[model samples]
Target: MGSVDKNPVPYCIVALMVVMMALSYGIQSADAQVITYRIHSDIFTELQDRYPEHAEDYWSSVKKAIRDGINAWIEVNPDLVVTPSHDERHNLLIEWIDSERVWGVEYHDRSLGYRIGIDFDSPEPDEYGASLLNPDIIKYVVAHEMGHVLGMGHSSDENHLMHGVENPKPKNIFDSKGYVVPHLSITDYRNIGGTQLDVSFHLQGYNVHDVAVVDINGTQYLVASTGNEGLHVLDMSNPDQPGLMDMDDSPSTDVWPLEGQPHIVQMYSDGFRVWSLSDPANIILLETVSHNSILDATLIYVDDTPLLVMVSKGLIQQYDLSDPHDARKSGAHHDNFNLLGVEDIHGVVRDSGSTYVLVDATFDGIQPYLIQPDKNPARVWHSFDQVEYYDHIQRIIEIDGSTYRITSTHDQIELYSVKPKIEPSDEDPETELIGHLLGYTVLGVDILEVGDSVYAVVATGPDGILGIHVGDKGAGKWTVG
Candidate 1:
C-alpha cells in the first residue's frame, strides 16, 4: 500500500536488515579503499558555455548515457559501489581525466580497490563530436570505466564492454535475436569473488526492447523484441552462433517457456500467443489470450503448477497452461504503487513453488505477496518496503541451504539471500528467496544453479545482456568465485 521511490534510498535502510547479515557473514567488502575520480568541470562547463543553444540538452543526454552505462555495468556485477568522493572505504569514483579530448580512465588498486576518471570536452562541431554527445557513446564510456573497476581487464572481444577504444562500434543493448551478450566474462566474476563486476557488451543491428530465454526439447531459445511488429527467436545452443526463429504478426512483448513442457508462451502488444515447440526446428501456434488493451507485457514466469504469471502496463495476469495447446487467463491484478506518481510496473519474480510473488514496487521498493490460488481474492502475506531500487530481478535460486535473489537497477547487480523470520505461532516455511539482476538500468534478470555454481543472465542495455557465474559459497557469504 505504501509508495516506492525510483532512487531506492528508502529501501536501502530496510534492505540493511538483510545486507547487514550478509556483511557480517563475510560478504567481501570494498572498505578503507580510497578511489578518487576527478571530473573535468572545465570541459563540461565550456561545453555548456560554447553550445549554449544545445549545451544543456547535450550535457543532459551524455549524463543519461553515462547513467545507462553505469546501470549496465552494475547488472553484471552488483557488489562494486560507486561514489563521487575519494573515500577510503569506497570502491569506485568517477573522475574527469581530460578536458580537451574528452576521454575517461579507470584505475584499480590491488591494495585500495577501484577508481575511474572520465573526460568530456567541447565537441568540434564534427560528426565525432556530435557522436560523443550521443547517449549510446556516453553509456559506452561509463560502462568501459566501470568494467575496469570491477576487476575486468581489457579484452580483444569486440562485443565485450572491456574491449579497447581502438574498436568502437556501439553494441545494441537489446537485439532481436535474443539476450545480448554481457560485457563481463566468467573469468571476471571468478576474480572478484562476491563483489560486483561492472562490464557490458554492445548490441549490434536491430533495435531490441526485451528478451527472454525458453528451453524447448533440450535446446535453449532466446526470444526478443524485434522492431515494433514481431518477435525474434534465437537458438542459444551455441552462445557464439545465435540464429533466429521466425514468428508471424505476434510482436512478442514477453516470452516464458513452460518448464518440462514443449510449449512457449508469448505476450504481444495485441494479446498472448502460445507456440507448440515439441519440434524445435518448427514452432506451431497453439492458442491466443486476446486482450484489447494489451499494448506491452514485460515479464513472465511459471508458478508451481502450470500457471503463467505476467506483468504488463502496471497489471499482473495469471494464466493456466495445463494443456500446452490451450492457454487461458485465470486471474489478474493491477499495481498502483508509485512515488513519482508514474504508473509503471518494471519487474516480477515467482518463488520456486509459485506460491509467492516478488514484485518491484517501483519507488515504493520491492514487496512480497503470498499467492492463494484457491481463495477467491488473492491475499498479501507480507509486504516489505525499501528493498532496493530493483528495476529487474533476473534469477532466484536456492544455493546450498539459502535462497538468494539477483537484482539489477541503476548500474549495479545485487545478490540478496533470504533470512528466515522466526514466528512464535506458525512454523517457518522452507522456501528460499533468490533472484537475478539485468537490464540497462537493471530492468530484468534470470538465473539458474548448476552443480556448485550459479549462472545469471541479465539485461544490461537496450540490447545488452550478460551471463554471470557465481561459484560455491561456504556458510559465511556468497562469493563470485
Candidate 2:
C-alpha cells in the first residue's frame, strides 16, 4: 500500500495503491478546458446483480448521482467545468464495487487516472437497510467523493459536504431537479479558480460554423450558419439578451453580410446562396449558385459595384452581382500560389479608390489581391512572415490615414499594419505585425468602436464570445479585458 498524501486530490478511506500508468483526465488545451469523466460498465452491472427487476430505476438514479456530484463543484466554482465522455478514455472514471466498509472512495492510479467507487450493496446495521443504495444517500456520497476530485478533503464539520460519513437524511444539497446545490466554505473558494467573464452569452445549437451581424432599420440582427440546424436569425439589439427572431431551413457553412444592404451571402458545402434580410423576422432566400467544394465566400464592393468572391478548391472566382437577382461570373484567378486549402476570405479593403481582397491560404499564408470591375484579380502581395498558421477572419480599418488589419488565427487574434505600395514603385506592399491577443479557436472577429475605445468581439469555438479591448484611439496598445 502506498501513501495517500502524494496523489493529486486524494481522499481515500482504504489503503491507497500506486499503479504505473499515465493519466488522461483533467487535460486542458487551447480549444477545450473541461474535465471529462466516463462511467464504468461495472456500475450498471452491479445494480443489475443486486436488484434485477428495478435495475433501470437504480441505473438512472446512479447516473444522476454522478452528474449531480460533478455539478456540486461547478455550483461552487463555475470555472471548474466538467462533462461526461462516452469514450472509454477520459479524465475520471465512475464505478460501482462490492464492498461493505466505506460508502465511497476517491482514489487515483498512475495508469487509470482518477476514479470513484461507490459501494451500492453495502448494508448499514442501523434502521437504514442497504442504505448505500438509497438515492439520496448515493447522491450525498457522490458529492463528497467529487469534492475530493476538486482537491477538497474531509471537513471536520459533520454538516458539510466534505464530511467523511454519509448522513441518513443528508442536508438539502439537492434541488427539485435532483441536482446538487453546493455549500462551500471560505477554504473552498480560496482553493478553486472561480469563473470569469469569458463567455458573455451562449445560444445552444449544433456545430455553428459562421456568423454575420448586420443592422436593419436601426435594429441589429445576427445571422448564424450551423451544420445541422440550418440558419438562425437573432435580434441583437440587446447584446446580452439576443432573441431568436427567425430561421431558415437551408444548411450553410459560412456567412457574410453585405454592408449597407439587406442581403447576406451564405456559403454551402457545394455552392453559395444569397438571402434577403430586409425583414429580419422573415429571412427569404433570393438566389442560389451551385458548384462544388466551395470553402468560403465573401461579398466585396469594387468601384461602387457589389461583387461576390468565392474560393473553391484552389481557385478564386469572382461573380458580378450588379443585378441582385442574377449573379454573373466575371473573372477567375487560378494561380500557382498553392492556395488549394484556402480557409477564409477576409473581406476586402477600399483605399484610394482601389479595392483589395485578402485571403487566408492555409498553406501559403495571407494573400492580398487588387481587384477591378471587369479584370482578373492581380496579386499585390503575399505575406510569408506570418506563414504556416491557419488564419481565419479579418477586419480592416483605416486609422489616421494608416491602414490596419486585425485577423484571427489558430488561437490568437493578430493585428497588422497594411501599407499598399503606390503604382510605378519598385517596392512591394508592406504588412507588419503590430500586436496579438492570445485566445482559443478564434472563429470570427468583429470590431466595435465606442467613443474612444475599440473592442474586438471574437467568437471562440468552445470558449464563447470574448470581447477584448483592442486599444483606445492613439493609445497603440492592446489588452485582454
Candidate 3:
C-alpha cells in the first residue's frame, strides 16, 4: 500500500484508497509555490471494463479527470500549469502494474519517469476495485497524486483529497473499509484545452450529431442533427452565413440520402423513415421501413441498384431500395451480435466495387463482411478488443485507401490501412491517430471532399457544428469537433 491519502475533502466515511505517494529525493517541495509537470495515465482493465457501457463519454471523462486534477492543484497555487506530458524529460507517467497485495504503488523521483502502478480487482473483502470506475473519485485520486508530483506531503485533514491511513495518521477511520460512492466534487480546474474553438452560430448547448453537406438540386445544403430537434437543414448555398432551411420532428439517430434523389433515409426506433427533400422548404416523410429497431443505415448504389445496409436489433440486413415502396431483401447475415448497439450503428463503409462491407458500433468494435453472389453476407474479420481499446467505434468513414473511425470517447479519429487486413488477423490493424476532435462529446462524422480540400462535418454533442478540414496528410486543420 502507498502512503496515507493527502489533501482530503468533504466526506461521510466514504472509503477510498487514494493518492499515496512514495517519493524519491531531490524533488522540489510544493510549499506555496506553483509547479507544473506533464502527466499521462495509461488505460488499463480497471478503466477499460467500463468502456462499452460508458462508451459515449468514457475516454473523454478520463481525459477530463486527469486534466481537471491538475487544475485543482493550480487552484492551490496560482502559478501552476501542470499539463499532459508530450515529450518532457521530467514528467509523470501514471501507469498500471502487476501487483497482488496493493491497489497501487507510487514510485517517484526528480528524474524523468515516476510510476503509478494502478492495481485492479483487489483480493477478498476489497471494494476499492469497483470504486475506481467513478470519475468523481478518480478526480480526487488524481489531484492528490498530482500534489505529490508537485512536491506536497501528507495532510491529516479528512476533508482534503490528500488524506488517508498512513503518514500523518491522527485517528484511523474506516481503515480497511473499501468502496466509496464519490460525490461530484466540483474542482476549480478550468483548462478546456486548446481544442475548443469558437463557433459563429449558436447551438444553445444542443449536442450536434450529424452534419452532412447535403446536395439538393445543384446547391450545397447542411443537414444537422440537434439532439431531440430531429434534423435541421441549413442553406449553405452561401457558405458565409448559413440560414436555417427547414426543421422536422423525426429525431433521427442516423441519416443518409438517396443518390441524386432529393430523399433522405433517417434511422428511427424499430425501423427507418424515408424523408423527401424535393422541396427543401418542406422535408416530407415518405414512408417507414420497419425491421427490428433499425440502429443505423447507409445508402450505397450497387451498379444501378440502389441498396441500403442496415443493422438493427441482432441482425445485419440489406434492402434494395430501387423501387422505393417495394424494397426487397437482397442480402443478410443473420446474427444478433453484429447488430445495432446501445445507440445505432456507429459507421458503415463499402469497397468501391462493393465487394466487401465494414460496420462499427458502441459495444461492438468493427466487423467486416464479404458480399456473396447469393446476396448473403459472410463474416470476413472481427475483433472487439482491438477496436474498443480506443473507445466505441461509433462512425467509420472510408477515404482514399484508408478508413477513418470516429469514437465517442474524446471524439478521437483514427485512420487505418484496412484493405490488407480485411481478413481477421492475430492482431488488429495498426491505426494512425489523427489526434482528438475537440468537443465535450461527439456522435458521427461525414467526410466531404471539394476539389483538393477534404473536410469533415462532425456531429458534436455540446460544441455545435465542427468543420475539420483534414489535409492530404499530417495533423489536419482541427477547428472544433
Where does candidate 2 have its weakest 10-residue lDDT segment? 187-196
Task: Give the C-alpha miss distance for residue 85 in model 1, angstroms.
Answer: 32
Candidate 1, residues 84-147, lDDT tens digits: the string is 4434444343434543332333334553344444444433212121233345444555555554
Give lDDT tens digits, candidate 3, residues 1-481.
1233332333222233323243434544444243334444355344456445554465566557666655765554444455555565544565554344454454555565444433333211122222333455456666656555554455455655545445643434322112121223422111122232222233434556666655765666677776577888877544446678788866666666566677766765667767777778888777787766566666655566666777666677787776555667788877766454534434444433444456664576666666543387677754433333322234455655556654455433333334346566435555655444222345666554444445556676655665555445323445565
lDDT of each: 0.47, 0.59, 0.52
**Candidate with the greatest lDDT versus the true structure:** 2
- State TM-scores per candidate: 0.46, 0.49, 0.46
Instruction: Please give the ranking of all candidate structures by TM-score, highest first, separated by commas.
Output: 2, 3, 1
